[model samples]
Target: MITLRDVVLRRGVKVLLDGATLTINPGEKVGLVGRNGAGKSSLFRLLDGTLHEDKGEFQVPAHWRMAQVAQDMPETDQSATRFVVEGDVTLLAAEREVAEAEASDDGERMAHAYMALNDAGAHDANARAQALILGLGFRLDELERPVNSFSGGWRMRLQLARALMCPSELLLLDEPTNHLDLDALVWLEAWLQRYPGTLLVISHDREFLDAVTQVTVHIEHAQLKRYGGNYSRFEDMRAEQMALQQAAFARQQDKIAHLQKFIDRFKAKASKAKQAQSRVKALERMERIAPVLAEADFTFEFAEPANLPNPMLVLQDVDFGYPGEDGAGPATIVRGVNRSVLAGQRIGILGANGQGKSTVVKTIARTLAPLAGTVTEGKGLNIGYFAQQELDVLSPRDNPLEHMIRLVKETTAQGRLSGQPTREQDLRSFLGTFNFTGDQVFQAVGSMSGGEKARLVLCMIVWQRPNLLLLDEPTNHLDLATREALSVALNEFEGTVMLVSHDRSLLRAVCDEFWLVSRGGIAPFDGDLDDYQRYLLDMAKQAREAQREQARAAEPPAPAPVVDRQAEAQRQKQRNEQLRPLKKELAQIEQRMAKLGDERAQLEAQLMQATQDPARLAEAGRRLKAVESELATVEARWLELSEAIEQAGA
Candidate 1:
């Protein structure tokens, strides 16, 4: 357990926490959430002993082992598997001890060293590391590749895998999903669900928090407030708290108003002079209640299209991919493509990494011309395309105002500018919508943070007033507030939107339907996010099985070694005894889960049809939520029991 009482933490002159206190119990999963600069990361630093409190008590058990993702990128030439396996320092050390003891011909020491190695699971630690890598979307062949050959984002994933590989009692992850795709993110959630540790994570992703956290700690106004349950529950409780606070404040204001009115009316009268004085004293004695601070409002709208088109764009027999090197030909990524994006349609592009999600987005944006087919667009079509790579769309030397100004000049030259000529001040005022103010607007793009750059790109996109927006991972670096702002803007926009993002909350909020990019083809994905998650898990399992089959096929046949049948039989009997209870529990949980899943699906169907009456819809929604939660819990338990059974058999 960790405890902090009246902790005061500061950096330079900025006081992050003022008398903030909180307790975190063992084996609890906690979400530390706040605004971008609200000291969430700083709190992690304090916990890891990189920072010290200026006042108050902060305590953690000295014997607790901690694990966190490394901030620094690895520039090593080591194999990726080896790099990840080394994250378990204790296991590696024990293995080294056995090797050294054998070399020294110390039989007694060698025996002790072997026992330590077995206790640390040294033999299978590499397998565990590889599993983590696979779960994080790494290919089997890439496991033995040099770590330095991977890109920066992938190296960060390697860091995450390393952190997970480490054996620890306390785990701290800061935005672990930043580099992951939706598939990998789903896999991570399941992995974290089974983690038997005291977990504290800092994440801006609301859905991730809701799925993994049992408690949410919010830092606001230099104070820490703890809420029970997940992020959604926290929001509900916080909204109620604020509402009551505001109501009490309104009542206090009304009482003060009546008292002041009486005093003002009677202060000049002779008989009522004493009463007025009493009223004045009473007013002085009254304590003022602070008004509840409402959440910051973010409202913006995309401009109406210059001309409405029934179908914004159409792709017929399109073979979309990158142009081949040296003017050979375009390499087909996904073939036999046929899609018609209609006006006011919201589509989500879904696929695993390197599976053509972005390729499809680029083809729609017309940045990459179709190899073998035509892409037809409506008359006077305007597009607001946001590339996944922020730097690709933004100039390093240009400022936000310059980007907007350049946009105006380019559009005006192309005869795409509407209404009247725009001025520099207009661009500056528009940039303020994204929280850029004063001298910040004049700063170079290279100096800006990732979030700031993302905002600037979005500002430019919205300013174009396009009828269609092709946004690829727009919320990658955005905070929760900005994400909400974007969602609201997209909801209100009278245009089409195509999104490819790992942020499930944003995807669920904005996308009306989904198109899956898989196996070099595009098709409609019929189910929702939950079904997609199951699909990803099944795909991973299939991949693992295929790899095992491939390895077996490649190996040369060998004669079996002589076995001790009696000992094996005894071992099998012991394994069965150990696994009996777990197998029974797994079967029961699976049965319950199937029933709950059916219940949820039925309730969801009812919800869709019950919207004519608000009461029916609300009740159906409530039942669906409970059934889904129960299903998730049971599924996690099944994973636990299955893993236990497998380990015991091993």
Candidate 2:
């Protein structure tokens, strides 16, 4: 159990929580949601006992063990598995005690140490750590790799895995899905679902919150407000609450206005002097409701492109990959691909991590060229590419204004800019749209938050006014509001978009078509996200089976079976290709379920309304029934296929 009563939390001079009270019971999976900079992290700090409340009481069960992701990036050359295993502090401590006891050869001490180690489950800790690592999307081979060898995103993932490895009663996860691809995200969800401990997660991912969190804790106006049920339920409830609050606020405003008017008219009059004085006293005594504010309504738009080209970009017999150690060798990631990007198309690219989704994006964005095929771009084609690795585009030391200015200068030098020299005023004005204002526009890009950096990147891309946009995980760091703004902007934009993101909300909102990048090839997926999830499940199962096969070493390789092996490889590729549409249909069914869920919620909300039509209520119920029937059929097929695939993979 945790309780914060009249708690005043401050960082430097800024107050985050002032006289706020909240209670969290044991085993509650709470989604901590707030606008960016609302001190959600500070609250986590409070829970971790690194920060203390300036006033009032804050309490947590003394016996409870807390586990949280480390704030710093790991710099050690430690094996990934070792790093994760060490997260079990109890196991580590027990092992140390056992070592000490053995060194002294104290029979009693050694006996006690052995018991403690056994109790701590030290023997199986490594296996548990490995499970956490694998669930977070690490390859089996990579588990033994040095931690320092991985990229920043992978390192962050490792840190998350390490935290999950810990045996704790309370777990704090801050943006755990930040670096995850869709497949990894789903895996994490499943893993978290099975966790028996209490969880308080800070995330802007609506789908994730809806899936894992049973309760929602919202921070607003320096106060904690609790809502029952998942994020979807919270949103619905919050909307209603805000509506009622706003109505009461409006009424209060009218009353205040009337009193003020009367006081103004009678303050100097002898006959009404007493009445005016009383009115003034009443106004002074009256409590005011804070005006409802939409948390930083962020909205930005991309200007229409100068030219729209059919088949804006084409990849023919493309074999794209990275160059090897020597200039003579090139390693292939995606091979034998054929695709076209047409003007005004919104294409969502989906795949498991390391399956060439980013590679395809890089190829289309021209960051890397196709190894063995021509990438033909239509005349006058321009690209505004948002790299998943933001550092590739953003200069650390440069200010937002400086970056924008440099972009214009670079474009002019490259003969890509037809506009006049960019003015500082124009740049600042543009940067302001992204909430970079006043001195903020002068702050180094490196000093900003990930969400801010992402916004700055988008700001730069918009300035380019490219005909085509290639966005790779653009919503990774964006809060729900900003993601919504981006989705709306993408929907409204005239240019073609090729987006690679794990954000289902963004994909559903912005994309009309899906492309599955898998098995060294890219194929058009005709299904929605749910089917993709099913496909991912099958893929993961097969991968696990492959690992098991490798570990068992049950079959010996034969040189004469080359043709059979080649044929097997060919069949696997064909099988993946064949599974694409079924995945798509499953995805459509998933999408339909989501829509039906939303519709049912809306109907229920309307039913509670005094003004709702009875006929409309009946019609809504009928539509819901029809949707349920269709969903049942699709879900049945989904189950049948899932089982079949599972058996086949086995």
Candidate 3:
């Protein structure tokens, strides 16, 4: 457990956290959410002890270990395993001791080294490392690959895995889901949900937070406030806060206006003059509702394209993978995947990180060649692909308007539209729909915030009016408000959409079908994400019950009493020292196991519901099996750990 008492953080002239006092109990999962520049990251750093506060006391238990998941990559060429395993500084010291003992060839030193290793939990460290990495979406081969080869996103994942691997009492994760694909994100959600250690995660992914976190911490006006529920519940509270403030302001204004009128009418009367003076003093004393941060006005409307044919895009047995990256047995990111996206079908892809979600998108967009498969385009179908990292694709020198014009001209050149003049007003209107206002439209795209630039990129895609849209992680850089607007626009869009995103809320809101792109094949799940999630939850609950029953069955029926009090006391003393950390770890792991079980059940139920749609049902079934397999692994590990603890206790 960690506590912050009147902590304040400052960055140059800006005050980040002002007199912030917060206490996080053991095993609490808190979601840190706020608008851009609201100091969520600053507050996180202060809590994690990475950054010192400018004022006030930060109280953290001396023995409580903490780890933070940073967004950026560390400058290192070490393999993923090295990056994570090296995080256990204590464990590393034990390893060094073991090496020294081996070199010295001393029996006493060797015995001490073995005990130290056991205390550090270094003996089974490799197996633990493998589970943590796999849970975070890395393959066994990628575990030994040099981390330098990974991009910033993948590096972030490595950082997250490292943070999770560390033996910590509290975990501070910032945008933890950013680099994760559908599968990894899902696993992470379940992991965090069951994590027994205190956690504070800063993320824009609503579903991720909703599924895992019970508390919501909002940073506003350089102060920290807590809410009882998740993101949606926080939004409701925020709305209520705004509404109450508005009402209070209205009453104050009304009183002031009435007082002014009374003052004017009764200036000559002594009693009335005193009353006016009192009113003026009251007005001066009133603390105005901190000018409600102007919420951006958003109205999204994407112009519909001309009539398009059914079966907008078709792929038959497509195979995809990064040949050398994931290892060269064809890598096979996705195999035997066949999909037909028809007009008006909004599809959302879900899977773990590194589970070929993006590969599926790239294959559909023809940006990456399918290792072996057939792709057929329906008659008159036009596709526009939006990469998750689209900022890299933008010309820094060009403004939003220029980029829009260029894309329009280029796309129209193929006679998709004959001599249709680019409409500047239409462009502006589209930009406005994405929350790009007057000056924002003219500003250089590079100068805009990530959210603003994302809006600009989305504006360009809408401007193209392609019959089929392939959007990869469309909600990545977008703010909550903008994401909501986007949800509306995508839902209203007439074109078929194949979107790859980890945002479950957006998927549920906009997608008519869930297209699961994983290790092999494309499976579609017809039905909303909510239902799918529900199915997963149910399946996990069932699994947990089964696991509990099995554990009970495996236990001996007869009980044993302490035959020797002194001997038992000695054994208890030794056991206490070893059991403390192990018990703590087991509790954390068990929580995560329960959460994972819930998710597996939900996916299974969703698969069952989607049986009517063969393609979708198949995809759901595949994902269900994958979830079950992952659940089994975690369950087995938990059993092994629990049994080990029981032995240690005996």
Candidate 4:
């Protein structure tokens, strides 16, 4: 559906894309993989028409629409729902026009209005909005909360939801999965699997691209290279290609050397002059092919935290709660909970928002004191904590280099290495591993992406090399690729870890056990994410069963010792049945919407490219619009289902 023909893009003297050509057909999902500063975002902008290539052509249908996932938040005071609905301003406008047309009773205009509304999927828009909101981890209550009240992570989700809501034949996503939790990530993966329109996604997540995309496009040295299959598949193919190319270059070098020797030996000999000249000419015409070099291996040298005696921290009968405003009332968030964090135990904490997971982490980190429980620090123990809000902790005015130097000294007062050993050089070398290079090292921390800041914070943590790592949603704003890389790094780290995260996959991959915090209590599970998830399902089922039993017991069989027994029984029965189907329907809609989305994308792309005849094009446009509208409708249904399910289950 889109093609970049011999594209050449340059900024000043640096060429970002040199004679690069790429083709994305309908229903093809392409992953654009590259390191930092390798033109991933620039390429997305080029496609979005925000930037232009110096040479070559970018071709798409005249009316083809495109949407890009925004990384930074736009200034807005609206709620998350409003933010998402506003993303497709065209749809909102079309809805208004369609409404007016229907009111006037103009057949032609009304028909156009229906198509517009259908294209915008006004019917299903709410469903899509709810699904996205939930998928992005927003609660029903939070959906109505003002966007400005949310943190950057939540703001990014709003942007993501907006992009997903828009109807576009082509979607350009850059690090789109950075802010999503496991549930949302899973939903997104499922959505992409069934997406029909062409997609060009830039991500650091290997497994994500592998699961969602069919093609891998690598950009390096200002050139584009295509590989069939997903990320891992591409890696294998690229490796083979590089090996073959290197062999070819080696043979060419040998031939050139031999020819040069012959030319030198026979230059003055009349009998061999013709052959020598021919060899020289051949050599002159030969275009040298430089062999590709593999990137340097990254060393994640963890600095160990200071040694402590017990290697264990325990919270004995902890009573914790959020303080009521002006001490009006006691709003207990957690109460009378006992928890033990042991040495060599990699525990994963899981819970819904506002369940006091962060509060628990804070209590353990000693950042917050328990209301009633005694928090005992293990002897000779030193803890290193990695918080989700890394950006908020740092001074925005200071550059990365300065921030690193300052943080290192502050966090690691007893850092093994004494004195600044070439601060600039050390900073550059350390930053380079995270893909920051040259002038980028000097850029203010404020200007960096969430992923960038996360990377920097992680790097700092590893540099200090703590004995026990306390990571609270460390993967919050990281791309999938980076997350996977982190998994590898954490796996290799020797120290114990205590992580409070919603990323089930990461928890499964890196954690050896689980510490589920709920209702102000910490429950330990000795298993992986699968086991933990099974446990949750079991618990939820138990809760449901308990509610049902209570309802049945509340109903009076006879009339003895009961006032209005029939009415009471009826009310209990009504309550029991209320949430059952809602949960089931929500689950069904979630799965169906993903499937329908893929189908709709396919249909939309076909409609976009099927014809040029005005009548035919117009019809196709209407159909495409309808499909998009239907998609939104599906999303809305899914949302209602989700809310219903939550209510029923509750």
Which candidate comes out best when scored by TM-score? 1
lDDT of 3 by residue, 39-114 (tens): 9877776776678988898877888888877566687888788888877767989999999999999998997897
In candidate 2, how many clashes are counted?
4
When summed lDDT is taken over every stretch of 10 residues in candidate 3, the lowest stretch is 535-544
What is candidate 2's lDDT per residue for 334-397, written digit by digit as tens? 8988788888899999988888989888888888877898888999998999999898889999
lDDT of each: 0.90, 0.89, 0.77, 0.75
What is candidate 4's lDDT per residue for 1-650, written digit by digit as tens? 67888999986687999989988777789999877677888888787777898999887766877887776776778877878987776788887998899899899899778777787778777767766776666765677788899877788888988988887878888877766654466668877787778888987666678879999899988888888899889989988889999999899889889999999999899999999999989998999988778765444445444563454787788877655678587666878777676777777777655677777777677776677768887775666678767854566778777877886677556544423233668877877877778888788888888777887777766655566788988876675557777788778766678887766667778887776667667677566665655655565446447656875898878755757988988877887688667767777777877877777777667666754567876776677687678779878787667656555556
RMSD vs true structure, all candidates:
14.7, 17.6, 17.4, 11.7
Q: TM-score for each prediction? A: 0.83, 0.82, 0.73, 0.72
Off by over 4 Å in 1: 99-106, 258-287, 326-330, 418-421, 560-650
Candidate with the larger lDDT of 2 and 3: 2
- Model 1, residue pairs in steric clash: none
Residue 281 C-alpha lDDT in model 2: 98
RMSD of 4: 11.7
Q: What is the TM-score (0 to 1) of candidate 1? A: 0.83
Candidate 1 lDDT score at position 291: 98
lDDT of candidate model 3 versus the reference: 0.77
Worst 10 residues of 4 by lDDT: 414-423
